[model samples]
Target chain A: MQRSNIYILVFSAVMTVLIGGAMSLTSVLLKPAQDKQVELDTKKKILGAVMDISTFDKPEEILNLYKARVKSVVVDIEGEIIATDDKGNPLIAEKVNAQKNHKIDREERLYPIYMILNELDPNVVEAYVFPMFGLGLWDWISGYVALESDLNTVKGVAFDHKGETPGLGARITEEKVRNRYKENKKIFSDAGNLESITMVKGEGITGLSMHEVDGLSGATITAKGVNKMLKEYLGCYQSFILNTRGLNGIAIN
Target chain B: MSAEATVVEKELKVEKKSAEPFLSKRRKNIVTDPLSDDNPITIQVLGICSALAVTVKLEPTLVMSIAVVFVIVFANLIISLMRNLIPGRIRIIVQLAVVATLVTLVSEFLKAYSYDMYKVLGAYVGLIITNCIVMGRLEAFAMANKPYDSILDGLGSGFGYAWIILTVAFFRELLGSGSIFDFKIFEAIGWATFPTNGLMVDSIGAFVVLGILIWIQRSKSGYVEH
Candidate 1:
C-alpha cells in the first residue's frame, strides 16, 4: 500500500518517457498526411475565391483542376516577381505562409497572387486572387479576394479565421456573409485609386454601394478587422495591379 | 474433515463469481446508469462547457462526442490497469498524463484523416483534456475498479455525455439554421420561407436548450435535488 519516494519517482519518470515517446512517434508518422491536408485546404480556399469547389470531393480532382486553371506568382511589395528566395529555393506562391508573412515588415513581405485562367483560352486571364491576413477580435482572420480581369470588380471572396466567436464573427466563413463582398463591390474608384471594399456597420443592410458591404451585427471589432485587412492588403498589392493592367494594354491613370 | 469440506465449498463460490457472464446485470448497470438516472451532463452537472460550445451545429458536436468517447474509454482502461502500481500520492498527475496523451493522439488522427471536421471542432478537441467527466470517472471508478468495469463506466459516462450534447445540437441546428447536419430541412420540404432564429446559433441558445433538456430529462427520470 505504501510506495517509497524513490519508487514513485521512478514510476513517474517511466510514465513520462513512455507517453512522450509514443506521442512524438505518432506525430512524426502523421506529419506527411497533415501537411498534405493543410496544403490542399489552402489551395481549396484560393480556388474557392473564384469558383465553387463544393462538388470536388477527391483531392486529385482539386489538384488537377488547380494545375489546369490556376497560375501563381510571388511578388514583393514593389510588384516585382521573386522567382526564388535568398537561399535559392524556388518560391512557390501556394507555399507562402500568409500567417507567417503577416508578421514580417510590410515593406519586406512577399505577396502571392493566383491567376485564374479561362479554361478554353489559356491566354485569357479570368480572375486574380489575393490572400489577405489580419487580426480578428479574438485571433487571426484571413481571406482570399478574387478580382475580375478588369482588376476593379470583385469576383468572389472567401474568409477564414482562428478562434473567432461562433455565430458572430465566425459567420465570415459562411457563404451568405462572403457574398456581401462578391455582390459587385469594387476595389478601385473611377479615378483608379485603390478604394478597397469596406464592410459598413450593422448587418442585413440593403442598398449597399459599389464599395460597401454589410457588416456582422454583433462583431463590430471583427468587421473592422476585415475592413482594415482588405484596405491594407489591397494597398500592398496596388502596384502589382497597376503593372498587370498596364501589361494587358489597359491604360493606368 | 468438516473444515476441509467448507474450504472446498468456498473455492467453488469464488470460481462461480469469476465465471459470471460478461454482460451480467451489475456490469450492464455500470454501462447504462449514466444514460438516464446518473447522466453526466444533467444529473451530475459535469462537462457543461463543451456541451454548450460545440452544440451549435450537429456535425461538429458529433465529432466532439466521438473524440471524447475515445479519450475517456482509453484513459479509464489504462488507469485501471495501472491502478495498483500507481502511487496514491501522484495518481492525479499520472491520470492527467495518460488522458493528455490520448487526447493528443485523437486530435492528431483527426487532423490527418478528417481535416474539415478538425477545423470545425478546432480548440474544442484540445479542450477535451480539460473536460472534468474524463477525470471524474478515472478518479471515482477507475482508480479502484477492475479494468473491465472501468471501461464500462467510461462507456456509460461517454454515451451519457454524447447524447445530451447531441440532443442540444439537434434542436440548435434545426431552429438556428432550419437544417439538420447542414441540410436545409425547410428548403427540401417546400417551406423555404422558414426563418431561423438567430438566438439559437449563439451560446445563449445552447444554454436555453440544455436547460430545457435537463428539466425534461430530470422530470422524466424523477431526479430530485437535495
Candidate 2:
C-alpha cells in the first residue's frame, strides 16, 4: 500500500522534532562533563611534557599532581607578564590554546608558560614548558616543550598532531621521538640569543651536538616543520625567559 | 520455529507477555547465530571500516564494541516499537535519525565519562552512525520483528561483530605494540629479544587479519558464494 503525502509529511515532521529534541537534550546534559574532559586532556598534555601520566591514573589524582607541581603564567610577545582583568586572578594557561591563537597577531596573543618545579622547593623552578604549533606535511602539529631553568636546554617534549600520515609523520607523538628532545640544547650561544634547535636527517652518526637531533627517516617535511616550529615558538619566549633568569637566582653571563 | 511463532504471536499484545522462558530457542538462535554462522563482520561483512580502524588496540576495540552493542540493541528495540506507525516512504529517514541520535548520545556519554578512551576512539564514535551493520539490522530485521526478538537479534549481531574485531585487535595489539591491554606481555615473559612487527600497527594489518579470519570461517562453515 502506497503511503499518502500527508502521512509522509507528518512522519518526517515528528521524527525531526523527536530526534532533534533527544540529541539537543543529551548535548546540554553532557556539556559540563565533556568540557571537563577537554580541560583534563589539555592538562594531561601539559603535564605529559614534564612527567609520565599512567593510563590507569584517575582524574583527581592527575589534577592534584598538576596543581601541586605546575604553575601557569601568561606573557606577551615582548616577554612581559600580561596582567589579569579587573579581578585579582591570574590568567589560566590551558585556556589559551596556542594553536587557535597562532593566527592572531603576536602582541595580542597570550603566551602560556608552564613552570615545572623541583621536588623539594616550589620556588626553585626546574623547567619552563612552552606550547608550540606548526604545519605538518598534511595538517597542524602541536606540542609542549619543557626548558631547563637555564632556558637553553630541553628537559623534555611531547607532540600531538592532526592528519599526519600514520606510522610515518605521525610517529612524532611516539615517546621515542619526543624523548630525543630531553636534555638536548634547544637554544645555542648566549643566554639572550635565541637559536632554535635544528632536526637533522640521519642518526647514529658522530657530531650530533647542541641544537640538533636526528629526524624521522621518511618524514623529511614533517621533521622540517618541527624544526621551524621550535625556532618560532622558542623565539617568542626568549625575552621573558632572559629577564626572569636573575629573579630565579640563576647566574647569567 | 515455534519460538519465532511465539514471538509473532506476542507482537500484538506487547504489554501482556505470558512469562515466556527467558531463552526461547528462536530467541537463543537470534543471539547466537551471529557468533559464528551469521557473523556480521566475517559472514555478512558489515561494518568493516570501524573493525579495521579501531582494532589497532585491544582496549579501544573493546570499548568500541560495547558502544556498538549498546547502540544496536536500543536502536533495534526503538525501531521495532515504532515499525507499524512509520510511513513506508519516510522509513529510511526515520532509521537514519534514530541511529544518528543514538550514536551522538553514545559519543557524548563517552566524552563525559571515558575521556582517555574517548580520545583514542576520537571521531570513530560519531562515525558509528555510518556503520552499515546498525542500519542493516534496523531495516532487515527490526522493521518486521517484535521488540523483544529485535533486541535479541541486535545483541547477537553486535556480539558477532565484537568477537571478530576483538579477535583481530588481539593479534594486532600483541604483535604491533608487544602489549595486551597496554601491558607489555612480551617483555613480561622475557621475550624482549622478539622484534615487534611494525606492519601489524597499520591498516593493512587489519585487512590481512580479517581476510584470513573470513577465509577460515567460510571454509569451516562450508559457505559458498552465489
Candidate 3:
C-alpha cells in the first residue's frame, strides 16, 4: 500500500523516539556497572605490573588485595607531592586519569605512583609502579612499569592499547612479550643515568643488553611507541627515583 | 462468556492448524537450508569481513557468532512483526533503526556483564551494526514473511554464518597457535615444540581457510555459481 508523506514522517518520528528511548535507558542503567568495570580494570592493570592477578577472578578479591598491598601518591614533574587539586580537594592518585593527564603540558601533569608493599610486612616497600601513556601505531597506548625498591631494575610491566592491530602490535599485552622487559632489564645504567628500557627492532634476538628488550617482529612502529613511552615517562620520574634513593640512604644511616 | 471464549479459541486453533502446522516441512527447510545449500557466507557471500577478522581465534569467534545470532534473530522478528505497517519508502530506514538498536543493546550488555570479552571484541562488536547478513535477511525475508518464520530464517542464516566462521577459526587457531580455545593442544600431547604457522595467525590466513571451506562446501552441496 502507498504510504502518505505524513504517515512516513510519523513512522520515522516514532522510530526515532523508540530507538532513542531504548538506547538512553540502556546507557543510564548500565553506566554504574560499566564505570565499576573501568575502575576494576584500572586497578587490575596497576596491580598487574607488580604481581600476577590472573588467578584472582573475583572482583572483590582483586579490590581487596589492591587495598591491602597498594598505596598511591600523586607526584609532579619535579617529583613533588601534590596534596590537593586546583579546587583544593585532596588528590587521590588512584582516581587520577592517566590519559587525560597525558595531553596536558608535561610540567603541569599529575603523575600517579603506586607503591607495592611487601606482603608479609607492609613497612617494607617491594616495588614502585608508574603509569605511562603515549601514542601507538594506530592510537593511544598506555602501560604500567614497576621498579624494584632498588629504583634501578624493572620488576614487571603491563601494557594496554586503545586500538592496535591484533596479533601484531597488540601482542604487547602477552605475558611472553611483556617478559622481555622483566628479564633482568635495568632502567638506570651503571653510571646512574636514567636510560629507560628500550624495545629494539626484530624479535628472538639473544644476549639483549641491560637497557634493551626484543621488539614485536611486524610491529616496529608500535615497538617504537612503547620505547618512547617508557623513556619519556621514566625521565619524568628520574628525580623521584633519585630522591627516594637518597632518603633511604639517610634513613639507613 | 467463558464457554463462548473457549469455542472461539478452539476455532482459531483449528484455523491455524488448517493454514499450516507450526513445524511444517517448508518451515524446517527455512531453518536448515542456510546451513549448507543457502549458506550465508559461502553461498550468499554476506558478512565475509567479520568472518575473516574474528576467525583468527576460536574464543572471540564463538562470542562474535553468538552476538550476531542474537542481533539477527531479534532484528528479523521485530521487522517481520512490523512488516505490514512499514512503508516501502521508509522500510530500509526502519530496518536499519531496529538492527542498530539491537546491536547497541548487545554491545552495551557485553560491556556491562563481560568486560573482558568486551575488550577482546573491541570495535568488532560495534561493526556488527553494519553486518550485511542482518540487514540482508531483514530485507529479503523478514519484510514479507511471518514473524516466526523470520526468526527461523534468522537462525538459519545466523548459524550458517556461525558454522563457517567457527570452522575457519578452528583451523586458524589450531595451526596458528597450536591451540584450541587457547589451550595448548600440542603441549598437552607432549609436542611442546610444535612450530605454529605464523601465516595462520594473520588475517590472510583467514582468507585461505575460508576459501578452502567454501570450495569444500560448494563441491559437497553441488552448488555452482552461474
Q: State the iRMSD of every prediction, in order shown.
A: 1.3, 2.3, 1.4
TM-score of each: 0.95, 0.85, 0.92
Instruction: Give the range of the ten consecutive residues with the poorest summed lDDT in model 1 chain A.
Output: A162-171
State candidate 3's DockQ.
0.57
lDDT tens per residue, model 2, A65-114: 88898988888888888768337766777787777789887667788889
Docking quality (DockQ) for each candidate: 0.68, 0.47, 0.57
Residue-level lDDT tens digits of model 1 in A65-159: 99999999999988999999999999999879899999999999999999999999988899999999999998999999999998999999988
For model 1, the docking class works out as medium
Who wins the lDDT comparison? 1
Q: Which regions in candidate 1 have their CA more than 4 angstroms from the true location?
A: A251-253, B1-7
Task: Rank the models by DockQ, top first.
Answer: 1, 3, 2
Q: State the fnat of candidate 2 relative to the true structure.
A: 0.64
Query: For model 3, how does the per-residue alpha-carbon lDDT over B1-226 read when each residue is reduced to its tens digit?
Result: 9999999999999998778978899999999999999999998888998888888899999999999999999999999999999999978889988988998998999889888788777778888988999999999999999899999999999999999999999999999999999999999999999999988988889989989998998899888889
Among the numbered candidates, top DockQ falls to 1
Candidate 2 chain A weakest lDDT stretch, 10 residues: A183-192
Error of 1 at A175 (Å): 1.4
Fnat values, candidates in order = 0.58, 0.64, 0.54
State the lDDT of candidate 3 residue by residue for A106-160, as single tens digits: 8999989999999999999999999999999989999999999988889999999
